[model samples]
Target: MKKPTMTQTLLFILVIGIGLFYALKYGNKAKKDIAEFESKKETNTTTKEIIELKYFGEIDLNKTEEYIDVLTNINGNEISIDLNIIEETISKKTIQPTINFLENLHEIEKIAHKQVLSDFKNGNIVKDYIEHHIGEFNDDDLKSLGIKTTDSPKERKQKFLNKIYLKRIGFYPEEWDSLAIFDFTISRDLTQYLIVLSFDSNGKFVDIYTES
Candidate 1:
């Protein structure tokens, strides 16, 4: 073929240049997208399940009246006495409970009992005691406490503050009418934020969240 005309040659070169530029841009975009996808794949994902975690909703410490109102609604006509036996440093030789559930630690501890725990460990009586007396949720919740127990009565007498694997069920005597096992706890560090709870034997929530 003969030499192409100037304009024709220029047009051909322009088309090739545009094609090359487009190829480069698309290649770069594809590479960037792949790199982003790989980066995302390296990260871990978490899942969460929501559930009602309180009584009468959440109690607000700032709104004293609000707590009073809810407490009235729940405590009024309910079989409970506002025991002013105000304990200053109430501590039990309670064995630290092994944390059962990671996500909802306090909730699991709420329903725990001494005898039931003794049964679970097959003979870990001492640990159950420490767990009940100690706050239930403490990070691992006593996962590290290596306490043991036994149904076979302690061959040797248990001493005071003697760390043991035991369980505790804080409930009103069976003879009492209209039973209410309203168990509550607060931060052992004097954060009197009441851990108010109200539930029946059937897992029904009388007061689902904080009264306030």
Candidate 2:
């Protein structure tokens, strides 16, 4: 085979050098774009949007998984809280309600229990009550409380729910025959609270009694 001329060799070298330069340039640009995207994502996670109570919508009361998750993560630390453990903790705090709001205590006890079971199955009871009772606070209210978020309204509301969850005081249980009534109170004070949640047997939320 004949050796290549100096001109041919020089041309080959020049082509290879140009290719390498373009490759390096492209690689650096791609890495910079990725880095910028990641930085924005981290900033978003660190500075979340403020959530308010008015945005409360349908909740999956049957799905305790998310509830346990928020309860554990309220500290801003990612922790896994087992459902069984949470239930046990709630049970320990369970007590009889100071006032039984049920009108027909004996009659409604069974009815309420049955209703709760049905609602849990239908995934509507807790959702309905929450829709009816959650606060009217808006974005302004959340800002006043020092809660900040860039998330959508629904996500904001969920964050607010989780935050308030950590302030839960205890569970109060009231009995009427076999029917069970439990009041889960959350507040800075044990006696008075921001909200009182009433649930029946089978861990179904029945009503919410709030203090104005």
Best by TM-score: 1
lDDT of candidate 1 over 139-189, digit per residue (tens): 333323322343123421232123221121122212122123343332234
In model 1, which runs have C-alpha deviations exceeding 4 angstroms?
45-97, 100-212
What lDDT does the true structure give each of the candidates? 0.33, 0.40
Candidate 2 lowest-lDDT run of ten: 48-57
Q: So what's the TM-score on candidate 2?
A: 0.25
Q: lDDT tens string, model 2, 1-212?
A: 99999999999999999999999999999999999999998865543222121112222222222232122232243222221113222221222221232222334334433443454346554334333333544556555544464766565544444444323222222232223332222223422433434445334445644452
Residue 181 error, candidate 1, Å: 11
